[model samples]
Target: MRNVGVREISRRTGFSPATVSNALNNKRGVNKDTAETIRRMAKELGYERSEHLDHIRFVLARKTGKILDEGTFHPGVIEGVERVAAQLKLQTTFTTIELSNREAAAKQAFEITHDMSNGIVLLGTEMAEEDYVLFRDPQAPLVVVDGWSDRLFFESVVTQNENSAFRAVTYLAEHGHRQIGYIAGDYRIKNFPLRERGYRRAMREAGLTIDSKWRVVVGTTVNTSYDAMKEWLSANPPLPTAFFVENDIMALGCMRAMTEQGIRIPEDVSVVGFDDLPYASVCNPPLTTARIPNREMGEIATHRLMDQIREPRDYTCVTHLSTTFVERQSVKFLQS
Candidate 1:
């Protein structure tokens, strides 16, 4: 069979040669969908996998239950990883780690990949400082997806949390909302703190008062967040004109709480959320949210891991992708 180069595939798919090469090599710069399309084209053209390429292992560290069960975020990211890996003609494996037993899990993960030349992609936003130490000196290359750490130096790909949150809050402010509240998630996740920081910064910029009563921290899940918001609403604390929630799931939960309390959405309390998950559009009042490119982040992280595997580097960097704002029915515009 004749070998089909990346350029031919790029021409066929309308992707750049670099993007096609990245997809074919299992590198991280291409989006999952584009990479998959390129891979299909390459396969049709008889592109073969190079024996020089190392296999990939995706290590999912879960603070909650399984990553798939947690929410649409992680699953979407995993889908991107799989699609890109398939295009690259690279072998991939998945392993789930319980955060409660991170030390043991990390050790086991290290042992499993110690002798192999495979690279690893660690997916989890809740990874603690100690959890990262286990993979610090793994003989194989590693990359982190949907999470970041200042303490560790692994190459990472994460959403632009701080800026995205700032934009979400600013959207509310622009709509004549000066009294904006925040529905936050557990701060243990690195992204949450960054988002909170952004929310605070935006509120300050808009000359809005940061009311402590309106800022509530709830568990990460939708159900837990719903219960927390319900309890918070019972106190009948002074409500803000608008709220910037950490994620769509939490936003949906808070909306449910508001409805149960007979508070009409957009009329009584306008709300905005982050991570425009699938349910964001289907909710009773479609969510106004900042869309995180989860799958794209996964694709880019995979490419970066491949680079690390090919060229072992002492220094590491984190890549942040920008978010887009999606306007929906959740936030009500007020007279300016």
Candidate 2:
């Protein structure tokens, strides 16, 4: 059997040399049907794709320190991405870009990634609306992970924030808690507003009165949340029987403050958190929270990027992965 070259494949498939090259190497810019046809013809003609086809770039548009945080959700997601890439025989290069200035960040990101790989997986949690526009017409196929932008259309994989928050609040209501409070995260993050909306909707549905004074907005980190909660608790405001926190880190911080003030968990005030992070299970009383499938979200995002690479198209829909409710000792069942 004779070895086939891209020229031969292109000649036989009646496609341009560039199109054949993109299709055979699994790069974007070719239509799905055409790419499939080229692959089939190339195989029939005994063509072997080059090793460069296996290259991919993972771009994290956040503070490098935050992405490297061992206790956060990003580590699990990165692990999942690496696992899937290995399974697919794809080589991945990880990089981080500071997103403080959208214009400068976009330019830097594009300069770093323009010709480096066949596709890109962008961790867009820190990216703003303008920052995403730079990648909208990317040189290679791109998939945004862990965030969504309403101003642009692109393939995205995000957690079911609204649905997960709804379930957590509903769970609290089912346990005979009518005054449900919310511990909100920074509204700047795209998912926080959705989670807050879900919390409000669930409270309304359960016929619970939402006391504005009980709702508190805190920073995204454990220390910040602890300080904020401590300050809020000093006011001696009427506390809700249960609180649904935006994430496990903040929930644990709030719990710490409550403990410091001699307030008991579940016995006095029940707490539920979103994103069942690793520490959630080992916290003082073990948190009752909604489990965001961080790893699975990463895996799905990688697969979606692969799909876009194989067939370049205008993909507009955002994919949302469902979250599971994790029952733990932190939340108590009140007498109806």
Candidate 3:
């Protein structure tokens, strides 16, 4: 006899694995009618979740699919969580919720946390402050990773975005580059805006006048951003001597666009990127980027979650980690 589980229930009912998991776990978003049907099918199949091992559930919430779907940082985060949870002998469950539909998303969250007894780690990558408020119930221990809620501070571990972006841009200034540009991504996330803020602040402090047209906004994914950058280049907008992109993925896209257009990097225009992802080092000219400790962030977040579970606290806190600036051959140092 085989052990029937969420997958079995999903296959029988023609529902997604996430929906089945949520329905079985007493989570919300499934209409009452749908829930009842799923529960009946689960019961008929004699589905039973393994209870021998303690479980760490992760709810990856996103306002849109662009950042969560395309970015590579989440794997490191999940890996960190797995490493820490494994040491404690707890199994893990991963689920994703889209916040584009705010009402439905809130309903889904409330249903889970209201009756939830276990600790859940939320991947708060593309979540906003209002979006954060939806999961503010104290019924369960919640830890956040890769993002933070400032007003309603939660137990979160996130890399420093604003400060890192500021440093990256300032470094360009130190290399005698005054006409610095910015490659902004259209991912509606907390980190993206923070990084742009850092870039703008650095420019101001460096006494560099930013031409509005020099800042180009592109899509989230590599292909999309590449095309968008190419389109921006076609518009014949004034180009800056250096560019600071929001993340490494977008940085690569913009670089590819420039490279294809017969523009030489460093020699023609210096570039700096954030999130020093794997391919950053391997890319031609190698990227000068701010390295985010994604794996460490995951490990720290899990340890923090364990602490929160063991010793429930009166108030929750957000943990901010600093980023390391990785220098490479991408940026050109002009003579002062």
Best by lDDT: 3
Cα lDDT for residue 261, candidate 3: 86
Q: List, residue by residue over 246-292, the lDDT tens digit for candidate 1.
A: 88878888899899999999899998998899999999799989998
Model 2 RMSD, rounded to 1 decimal: 7.2
lDDT of 2 by residue, 1-336 (tens): 454666577789899766876776677889999999999997888765322345667787874332234347777778778888899898878877777666777666655444424567788776667677666545456678887778877788898989889989998998899888889865356777889999999988998899998889886678877888998889877788999998887888889988998889989899999888888999989999988888887788788877765665645569888998999999989976
| Candidate 1 RMSD to the real structure | 12.4
For all predictions, the C-alpha RMSD in Å is 12.4, 7.2, 7.9
Error of 1 at 268 (Å): 0.9
Q: Each candidate's TM vs. the true structure? A: 0.81, 0.81, 0.81
Cα-based lDDT for every prediction: 0.79, 0.78, 0.82
The parts of candidate 2 lying over 4 Å away from their true place are 1-52, 63-71, 101-104
Per-residue lDDT value at 26 in model 3: 74
Ranking of predictions according to lDDT: 3, 1, 2
Residue lDDT tens for model 3, 1-336 = 346656577889999766776787676687888888899998898766433325777788977778767778888888988898889888878877788888888777865553334467789888878888888643456788987777776888887889999999999998899999888888667888888889889999999998887888998888889999999888666678899988888889999999988888989999899888899999988999999888888888888877875675667777889999999999999975
